[model samples]
Target: MDEHDRTRTPVAGRVEADDRPAPLPRRITVGIIVNPKHSATLRAYADLVPQLQKAGAHYRSMTTSVERSGRWQAEQLIDWGADTVIILGGDGTIRAAAPVLAEAGTLTSLVPTGTANVLSRHIGLRSCRHAIDHCVRTVASIIRDVPTNLRGIPVNAAEFRRADGSRHRTEFISLAGIGGDARAIAHHHFATGLLGYTWGAARALFVVNFTASTGATVGAGDTSGTEGSASGQVWSVMASKVARPAGPIAVFPQARIDAEAFTVVTVGPIPDRLIARCRAWAGIATACLQGRPQAHPLMDYRCTTDMWVSVESPVPAQLDGDLIGDCLELRVSAGEKKLLVSAPTT
Candidate 1:
């Protein structure tokens, strides 16, 4: 038998003869979550919903504002009997619905609507209408032979308690930082509308400084795995699900989605020379774009299941893409895999 024949299974989860093709559904129900604040996202959905309907698929959308809408969206989608969940926002939006979808054992699709669709790019999904069309076709093909045991990867979701006794939850789909990157994100959040992140990153480059007294202990695979030592005061502690760290940055290229663990990349105290810091950033960017792991003086990469971070003083923490408040003691652990749809390999 050929490879395709070997992999063939009936849509109803039964093994059938090679000559018999599994029946495809006439109408597949999909639940969509949209970011109301993003105009581009609204446009994408306006185009996509009509296309899906024309293709004989039913699309249900939940429009949301900045308020916490992910959990409610997931509940509604499941209640609507959606076969799959489609997220039309950025990493933060995706991260918001991931745990719920994962627990429901439903497949999740990304539309790359946010400003920095970093996770979408990392998974080999291009950012545009063409990519959306490709994703739709792929989902159609898989409907018949829906894998019984869908694979999910572990991700760390951090909970932060503020000094005022209030708690907030942040999910990190890519990388989460506690110092420099955190400050950059915070600055970007508050800056003027135009070129906010760019300006914030630039300001962070000049203002952020680190010393040798701060450090973090990372636990990989089982949280109890071998503990690694710190070289200098950890200016930032990054826990990433994807190999690429975030944005135009890529610190650990060896990390893979299917890897049984997460990559913990730590940077020593801030470098003395500005040029060295720039070089480090450049190195990481190169690694991410090229899909290769590169070594640099300021960074150390390792795989772990659990990580315990201790900072000399409280500092900001971020997950996925949003910034939580300051944390003096932080514990990170790997969670179960969440279902994600990706482009089919040719």
Candidate 2:
């Protein structure tokens, strides 16, 4: 294998040049949290750091060994006075750091290295696949484009209340999962990367417990309006702030993170026949790829301040993109208080 291929997550196509002007080097301290599972290296970020250093930027770097530990590493960097924190992995890596940075009002940036770098896409960073010279240049351009005063858009987060009365809050900047989406997340192998998610989703279709038979009572109410309800068996429910899922697919095409409201989409149950299952899967996939919401009987869409789901039977759910285990009920809402985000600078 060539040196370029050795340092990157194996991907299609060749790298390209970064066209942005070089950013002025500044004397700043930067804290970096890298996910080793993605096979990122100090050299992988070579294009980004040197420019910062040219301006006299000091740096500290650490690799996260477990899920969510990147946040702890970022906290360490902040304690040591890092003026900015750079995340060098996928959305999960960034998610781990975002809450911490938001709470502290710290600035953050990304060098996406995951299968589907949703956060990177949201911030308008160009996608690069390899560690070749072209890839380096593209990343450098993104660093140059980093905005000075990052304005974080507000997002809806979910609060889950189990039948036992225990409750906890999980912030989902992009999408919140219920039913099959959550089950797929819970069942997916952590080591399998992107393919794991696909396989888990495919398998969920055949598994009886994951079928739409898992009933739910769904409700919606605007922040300034009256309460309403929608209930029945569901294959999955996604409360989305962003239109896309897993990258290009627009499962919630009308969802917007920057807006005060979000959308709750419930997938009607799958049919018992094999032919119907395959057709349902294909139809939903096609509609999503087209970036159009389906108007079929198998789906229902609602836009509101909050969407609540009370599961008839326990099923799994995901927050952001991480599997947060099973729950009896969940309430997703964009609360009055906004999360302070140190968004990308361009």
Candidate 3:
């Protein structure tokens, strides 16, 4: 789309002045990657380009289609000399572009324009315009003042090898799952479009036997090494970096952005009772909203750097929010890589 097609009327909201002192010099080059499949991609482009131009920053924009891989497009933008890359899409879109940005070792910004904006929620950025403005201003000020040590949190990237011997890499700012959760994701994918997550949750209810095999080992540790135990009849396994996955799902309530390790939540086999499941769901919801430090009998939380998950039979697995088919052996640990991201100041 042309400049006219990309421009939109700025929301008539007041721009709050930053409390930090102004910088002396300001010059920046910004690139935007838009996922056309996202519901809010068009609106995000319209709302952000004008703000970038008005701020006197050089900008480039590209739209992502199924034919064109998000990672390839992001790499092209970085090669085109983007000091900072801004992405407009959901968690999946971000996952696609993250490794590319991280490989380039560039500071990346995000505009939450997808169904599950988990990363955006974690960084406290509410909208596309908010993220764009924050990125532009931060870059400009960095050029002017050399004293600011403002930096983005580094996050772990995960790689999932499918039962078919194919591997896919994804970045998860929220949570990843295997077993019942993976099956739920697959069901969700088949049942609905972007809104399939609701259907997935419903499917989880009718299905009592979601795990392919209960006897398996779930390993977890840090860059130091992996440590954990084996459990039989695994229900749901979640590894999270942030507190809330999306909405009210707080599987890891004590997770922090700057923590040296990640938290794993594994649900062991239990009686398939509605009341028990409801209680577990309630605990997750309450922890997410109230920041309470409580644990459920079905759920166990452990902190570690590396983890190995082996199932008795082939089970569905997912990285970030994307399904990775089925797998008998899954090894997940903090990869020796990191992503640079922009976050709002507290």
C-alpha lDDT values of all predictions: 0.66, 0.66, 0.68
Task: List clashing residue pairs in candidate 3.
Answer: 25-144, 214-232, 214-233, 219-307, 221-304, 221-305, 221-306, 222-305, 222-306
User: What is candidate 3's CA lDDT for residue 55?
Assistant: 71
Q: Which candidate ranks first by lDDT, i.e. highest? A: 3
lDDT of 3 by residue, 76-130 (tens): 8888998878888877777778778877887787888777687778877876778
Q: Candidate 1's residue-wise lDDT over 129-201, tens digit each? A: 8557765774565555554223354555665555445666545566666677777777886554436766767
Error of 3 at 1 (Å): 60
Candidate 2 C-alpha lDDT tens digits along 198-307: 87877777654343322222333333455666566678887777776675677777777666676777786777688988898778777766666566667678776677
Score candidate 3 by lDDT: 0.68
RMSD of every candidate to native, in Å, equals 8.8, 13.4, 11.2
Question: Using Cα atoms with residue i matched to residue i, what is each candidate's TM-score against the true structure?
Answer: 0.78, 0.75, 0.79
Model 1 ranges off by over 4 Å: 1-25, 142-151, 161-170, 190-194, 210-226, 229-232, 247-249, 272-294
